[model samples]
Target: MTAAQARTGDKNCRVVQWATGNIGLRSLRAIIEHPKLSLAGLYVYSDAKAGCDAGELCGLPPVGVRATRSIDDILALKADCVLYMPQTIDVDDLCSLLESGSNVVTTRTEFHHPARLDRAVRERIEAACRRGGTSLHSTGSSPGFITEAMPLVLLSLQRRLDVLRIHEYADCSSRDSPEMIFNIMGFGQAPNPQAEAGRAWYLREEFGPSLRVIAEAVGLSFDSVESSGQVALARKRTTIAAGVVEAGTVAAMRTTVSGMRNGKPLMSFTANWFVSYDIDADWKLRGDGWQVEVEGDCPLDMHLHFTVPEARKAATTPGYTAHRAINAVRYVCAAAPGIRTSVELPQIVTDLSAQA
Candidate 1:
């Protein structure tokens, strides 16, 4: 543990839930229910959510924590940490929070690897951390913790290490975001190599740095990183919770990013996200949940599966993403001031008891 973590001791960590979106709502609930944490403030971007009780926004009884649309109010609150969960990352706003001496735990993809951030932005974050003496940590579902952090933990038992592979097969039919499903994911678009290449570039830049973190943690030097993607066309026109899926349009996508050493792949991350089960029935929903495969002297393969009610299926992804960060608040608060990753933090375990 770093000096920051040691200084935190056993006090109840006060937290502000910033933004109450899908993941934010889950985070609000988690912070309220966590044994070692307290929900001190709530931040909301939507006018509709403002002035509402945090618990009510999360479908629970009022907890006396009212949501506010004002960032200034959040900044003024006496809190130890903020669970930043905005849809789009606003670096300036984040830096402001850090500068106010509040440690941060976010599910933002861009912050997963601070080194991957633009030079200017990276330096700004570091400066803020130094000025405020606070830390920033990021984690999420697939690209965040499942693929990178979890695999690294499992690899600790290995007597020898050669290659690491992580896979995620998600059925996103129940997701609530229509724009994300249809527009951003190209769910109803024709296969275009140029567009696919653009997506591959995104995957590479988004996840490549994370793979580098893993490589460095395991003492491997990677020579190159490559990204590729394939799309599965819809078998037939279908309608799901998100939107319509036209036949011949993209129904499923498989994106892979690999880190290579000495001409062989050292680490690979693959995500198979789909809106329906018809696109590639054989491969769709194949894994129990997330899978990590390692090839070494003590070869190992592991799967993580969760059973949730059908009504809550759409929330599983965001819920896990929120918990990954929420559960890390204790460690992040105690770590040295600066951007930190799951690889640097201690193992995060969930504690649901009322007493710390």
Candidate 2:
């Protein structure tokens, strides 16, 4: 049987957890507790995490699966699917996984829309799937949930569609990740050319393809994708949970990735992420959640909010991202070989029977 045919059923899917980061760590815990899935192997990037047990890394009892740092070790291991959630995209590692007879369900946001991907990269990934007869899928909360899942439903009621836009909001005033805020996100740093360049690159490379997925699902063609953003600076120095936002530093950022059809945006995804409401710019603060709107025959507006308390945000928020990808394992494994966009698969159903 082909590897796709050999992928086990929901009752006993063998899964490998890759990179125990925020979302990946929660997924590892879920895999250990999930009745339908088994933790076959674990992959970690740090030497400190390499020898630790998978369950322990996730704050659970040992599951007897030790984490490894070698790609060859993971390739030789037998697994029906790999949860490829690293901080960045590594097409080489991903291709090797698919070509090694293991399917992939990732949060990397690289394969959400195959047609939008660079010609050579998309072809390389598809070729790997063909050789191994395995399937690969990409999913996560923002680009996956607010980008594809929610909009897909909102647009269903519309017949003569004009435009669809999705917005992601985050109130990061109470976030406690200092490294993430000050260093990685450049929250308290003065605006520089490098920061603008980085945001533009992310928009074109990562979130750009996701916008195209929305258009593809709705049968709209994109002439091009327009990417842009502007930074909101702090008016005065203020201390929040993450760190102190110095006056005139970057306090917030808004990024817009639009799928343009005939020089106009038919579909757009905007990210409104702010560390404080005391910024010099007049930006909306809707707490931490998402808002999706469609202007069409039906004309509907809706917002999905995160209800997690401030104390539990770090622990609970990742579940929103991890669970959807985890729940997609069965459908992805059952899919035909190649990049499985959300539109091509069935509605993902959560197998929560084990929770009882």
Candidate 3:
């Protein structure tokens, strides 16, 4: 049976929040507060977080939902969907959940477009969806709405289009993940073209599919996708929330995945991430937030900014990521069983009734 055909008579959609990291914690809070959703289960990776109240984990009063470390326990819950948010991508774990008959919405970009995945891995996910009649969707702040969905929405206003460029500038010093900063981002490493090439490859592996997804959604075709990356070294030793960065090490990096049509750039996905304010170079599109620029018969440029305390700057991105996935839970549960994207889902409406 398809996901739309599957019936759940419950008034409130039962949801299991998987993982309680930055994004997960925010998602848990949103789920508990959303009137149409119920916090059915809490899945955690850390033993310390086990048995703790879900509300306490998010710095709120106890809401009676306790965190669990066992995957089996989460699987046993009668949940309509799972908000899967973890630090890293784990296809095996995601497949396991889908195979157990739970629709999923995740911030992980790997599944944003499963067509980019290996034939074997993609087939495995498809098989799981077929077996359980579930749907899985992947989204986030940058690769999700910023680069793909938002640009498409803006382009719809124009009568004709030629080029689209999405630029993201973020201060990464507030991020708490050392592994993500050092290993994945190569933040503290010495600059080398070969090493930078590897980082570019990682960018393509992560966001390339989403670019392709956008291209297809807009009725544009790309002959090839090209990736390029450059890094800015730190001028002085720096200390931030994540860890210390030595002088002369990598501090900031800019990467792009461009779709080439007819040997010209049709669409470009550019990201500028910085660990410290002081770097060899400073590049900002509009002094902060996300910038989307389109060149065509009617040229247009937009800058999206969020107002928050200086200390809470880092949390803004993750908060947006969580809400994007959480707000799509209902649509994901009702869509056809398969790997889905924002293009296939309904417009996400935020529940502002619970907001202060």
Candidate 4:
């Protein structure tokens, strides 16, 4: 191996799988089957999944790795990188992993733009990076690929730019994670105007940094990145992958974050997520995918969609986010210490030889 490759990881990079949720489970399988990676350990939460073999969890033969619930156990492993895909992020756990000298690539949207992050949290992460000389990065499909990566590619073709708008549509009816769909996403719940408003504000905070990242890239200063949200109730009872959405309950939600320059939107991202189209609101629901439009000197429009039949969507959708995190393992591991935004890292080059 070359010096740089050795410093990061050899061809067989050792990775620790952080969780086994929908996305994490897909990541787990990808890592195990990856020709360039080897599974070092697995971390899971519930007692039922704790002692189970990794291969059993994903329907492969036993690979001899067992899942554990303890973070300390994970820290003790000799892993070059940790594919951290938990639903909620724990800052202390993140810091500990960095301090353990393992580079981290997470799907959480928190570290997309470190400068826009809360001052105290940013400082702590930086300190951990300095001490351990390890890097941390946050990436996923929406706030990641459609947010930063694709925009950069499109902007390079333009001399003068006007506005870029990204619309993400997800038919989440096939998602099997009940907690994610029901509690975290607030689907199947009666709307409280106040609670919905709070959720909107939370969405703003989550996506605002991404807008700042784009603003920084384009050399435009924004007054602020603003956000708003709207919700639609179910017109009748609808059965989804997770459970039931009764009439008058939240079935669809749309949240938007816009980068405002001089009190006007310069760049915007809108996410449309729905369990079913039979809703009280006449939302123009598209298939599960993304749409990007650049209205500028050189206008560009594109659509990215999933062609998987609905029967396979539940098993296949996680890969959309998980694969990116898996593909970024090498880039983040070799990066300089501190928060590595998608813009800072090298282009992700994948190894698909295993497919042959």
Candidate 5:
């Protein structure tokens, strides 16, 4: 083995995946199959999943790693790293995990910035990592990597800076998220009293974290960001292979920011899934006498639609996002270890096809 490989081997790093849901399962499948990574443990909150074979539930053959519900078991196994999904909202759980001396990577937006966290909790995680010689990384498919890092990368091509705009349009209804999430994004059923209570929409909270990332990437931050959403009802109902979906209802919402050089937005815009689907989510750039248009499907095989008319780009775009995240992992891992917001992290190159 090369010197670098030898060092990495000495660590004997093993990963513990913290969840087994959709995103978790996908991440597990990807990480487990990687040559350099191995499953140390699978931690689930549900008793039903406990003691199950981790790989089988994740749609893979057994890898000799069984699911366990005990955090102590995971720590006892001496896992070098933990890949955690964003499902756990319990601050206490976070504190305990960080204190366990295991490095962590998560998709949690709440941990995007240490400033946004409780001072005590932040100090605990930071102190734990410092004492244990580990790190904590938090990112998402969007805010965590793509929209933030992609813009920073594009700036390398520019001679002068005037304005930067990053756009993300997702047909979230296309995903199999929970009903509360669907309803908040104006999907699924109509307005009901119970639904209203569950209406913590995903757009701003989910997408806003990326904006913060972008600002930090370009050495800018916004103090005041203005956001608003509108519900568009379809003129007709439609159904995909998944199920029937209303065509029109809360069709879209736009979020934009314009203000300070730090957190202020020179300009910004957001289009809800419904609105963007009805319209177009192609990326556009106009600067340095250069105009670039970007739009495509995600890169996942299931979402790929080469034969389809509109969605050929859908499958391609997400793959772009996913690839960017994977590529960023090396940089994030190497950077100063702690729970860092997007801005706190160093600028990462976004070309997934690039060789390390």
Candidate 6:
């Protein structure tokens, strides 16, 4: 039988998990504890956790899913879907999963702008998704939630936007791994190299993705664009956290972009991050000859419209990001997959009005 046929043939709706990091653990918990989903199998890279119960890792009661070290073995289980959260790994692993007919939802930033990725990787995932009739979705926080959904909501005001700026601050020190610190701070590099080139591609994938959402809402389009970024330096008296970072170093960045309409700058945005505590997405607009700023109490309260304890806020972002990743899966499963730029996805809010 074909891989697609094989996947559908499995009677048990096994929800396989890959990676056991913070997000992976979060996905695992969400799946097992969620009333609608089931915990099937887990794919942990390290051998130390093999054969251990997945629930124990999350400090939850046993749910019967065991962590395994082998990808091949996990695939052999014929899982219905896989929740993937690899910080750094070959894209081929993702392509393999797609080809194997397993639906996927990943927090990897690679899917933000799929077109620019290696052709082989893109084609492999697309082909596998198509052949298996399975779906592949790319989503996460800055790029997925605030970047896409928040901006779309701003358009409800129906004002002409002269400039669109989104400022976000994520405290990476709170993360569980050193790799996350570097990813956010842009470690091991001179100050602001991404800005000098006018090509902060990652920020573009995010800001631009978000920009597109507002653009569609404001009823305008861009003919050209300009982006720049800068690394900001600050003195640290002590480590940002107990185990995450030291006292002295470049700790954050200021990324900006100017999206133009008909060669004139119409919308502009700035994104900022720091080692200290702050997280939000705000916007400025001009309509009816008035200027306004759309600011949220915090990123979570602003994005999801609910206030959470400051101490628990760090834990909240991943789940917020993970849900967006989860939403993306439903689309990829329908035989429509590709390098979907912000232009392709646009921006639409699913639950904002319901909260009221």
**TM-score, one value per model:** 0.90, 0.93, 0.88, 0.90, 0.72, 0.70
| lDDT scores in order | 0.83, 0.86, 0.83, 0.87, 0.54, 0.59
Which stretches in model 6 have alpha-carbon errors above 4 Å? 1-13, 156-161, 171-202, 205-225, 231-239, 242-252, 258-260, 263-269, 276-307, 327-356
Stronger candidate by lDDT (1 vs 6): 1
Best by lDDT: 4
Error of 1 at 200 (Å): 1.3
Candidate 6: 10-residue stretch with minimal lDDT: 283-292
TM-score attained by model 1:
0.90
Model 1 weakest lDDT span, ten residues long: 1-10
The digit string of per-residue lDDT tens for model 6 on 1-356 reads 23243223324345777888877877777777553346778888888889999999877998787899887887777766788888775667776777787788777766655554578777877787777667666677666555555555664554455555555544445455455555444532345564434436656654564455556545787776678776545444335552433334455555667678877665656565555422122222111111224533222223233255547866765576666654443343433454444335434223222234
Estimate the lDDT of model 2: 0.86
Candidate 4, 1-356: lDDT as tens digits: 23345324446779999989889999999999998899999999889999899989988999999999989889999599999988798889999999889999999988998987789999998999889899999988878888888998998888877888999898888887799899988899988677677877887887788878877987887898788888999999999889988889999998888989887888899989999898888778899898999988899999998899988887888898999999888888788999999878877766776878
lDDT of model 4, residue 330: 85
Cα lDDT tens digits, model 1, 221-323, are: 6899999988888889989788789998888888888999889888898888887778744664563378889999889888877677668676665677888
Better of 4 and 6 by lDDT: 4
| Location of the lowest summed lDDT over 10 successive residues in candidate 5 | 285-294
Best by TM-score: 2
Candidate RMSDs in Å, in order, are 2.8, 3.0, 3.6, 2.9, 7.2, 7.9
Model 2, 45-84: lDDT tens per residue?
9999998989889999888999999999899986889999
